[model samples]
Target: MSVTGAGAASSTPASGAGRRVVILRHAETVDNAARVWQGHKDTELSETGRQQVAAAAPHLAAYRPALLVSSDLQRAAATADAIASLTGLEVRLDARLREVHVGEWQGMHADEVRERYPETIAALDRGEDVPRGLTGETRAEVAHRVGECVREVERELLPGETAVIVAHGVSGRIGATELVGLDQDVSDVIFRGIDNCHWIELVESSKSFSARSRWRISGWNLGPWRL
Candidate 1:
């Protein structure tokens, strides 16, 4: 089933009033390179990551977003900081944009999880909800939270303004799928793997909004260097 909302539309930026929301995944991190589950585990960008952001700055500068927002997580926040510095826009920290907490899987390499908790790992791979960490959030939960966050951005930001959101791959994918009215299962499969520092643009109109893949290389599975 396709999800519909005030923020769903075609690829082109809409006319009339309403703010355009651009979602960007953060640059490369050491955790990303190691193929570890880094949910809610704070990790700084590697030296190469910093350079990647530097290279991407020019492309982001083209948008001239009025406000730049990011998850409070270090990886995303640091990326927002760099973009803000380049664009002269202040960074807004939104905890709601943080990555989905992977519970017991946090900070563990994929191989380790597969070896140690084979059943749980297999369940996750199959999209079956098993008991995760005591406080960890599920994919469904994260989707709801991210949906609300997108609504809040539209409600609070001024019409005709553009806002840039720096977030994690999974969360960003969820948000994108929701915005585009795609089926959850399809979106889940398509977004299961995303690259670092990739970006998607969503343009808003008076009645609705639409999205398009802007730079997949940075956000799909490749690094910023490759872009």
Candidate 2:
């Protein structure tokens, strides 16, 4: 079944024997500020992004994350570093958590992309799951790799522990959708791009044994209120 930030029916918080996973979108990057497509383009966080990290770091650290992982890209790595600074955990770099590759569209402004590929843009807005930039990975491709990374995290985390993964906007949602086994159609329609420095939390149900129904999205687009 598909789950939405606003549509999930019920989410059983992890019990004493279950685990929690938090997939965090990295802070804003220069590309983000400029409304550019940054698929696989390594960019540093903007000054505002650094401030966002300062506001958001304490909350993620409070989770006392048992494992910290992130995309190798500088933007995600930088955000992960902040949380690691407080938690004393090593940041495990995972390429699979990187954003959907936009192919030829990397570094292009959103306006340019919209003008050049109106049909593609329209298709995406309709949740068609097509390649983003004529050569970019399709949503399914992104989900496959993202699913691999998330499942690995599931194995690494023990009951009563929380794991934090620093991820990109699109990939983060794909990972969350994979973890919760939400209906893809529902996710495509309902799960929009998450805001910078925000996060989604997934908890494994202690009562469920099936992979398809074991996890739930307990929170979505949650972030710091200060700054």
* Top of the candidates by TM-score: 2
Instruction: Estimate the TM-score for candidate 2.
Output: 0.91
Q: Which residue pairs overlap in candidate 1's backbone?
A: 8-209, 9-209, 9-210, 195-219, 195-220, 195-221, 198-218, 198-219
Q: What's model 2's lDDT at 20? A: 86
TM-score of 1: 0.79
Give each model's clash number.
Answer: 8, 2
Q: Which one wins on lDDT?
A: 2
Deviation from native of the Cα of residue 122 in model 1, angstroms? 1.8
Per-residue CA lDDT of candidate 1, range 93-188, in tens? 988889989888888888887888877767777977554543578777888888778667756766566677888988887776666566668766
Residue range 87-175, candidate 2, lDDT tens digits: 89999999999999998899999999999999999998777888989999998999999999999998998777888999999899989
Candidate 2 stretches greater than 4 Å from native: 1-15
C-alpha lDDT of residue 215 in model 2 = 91
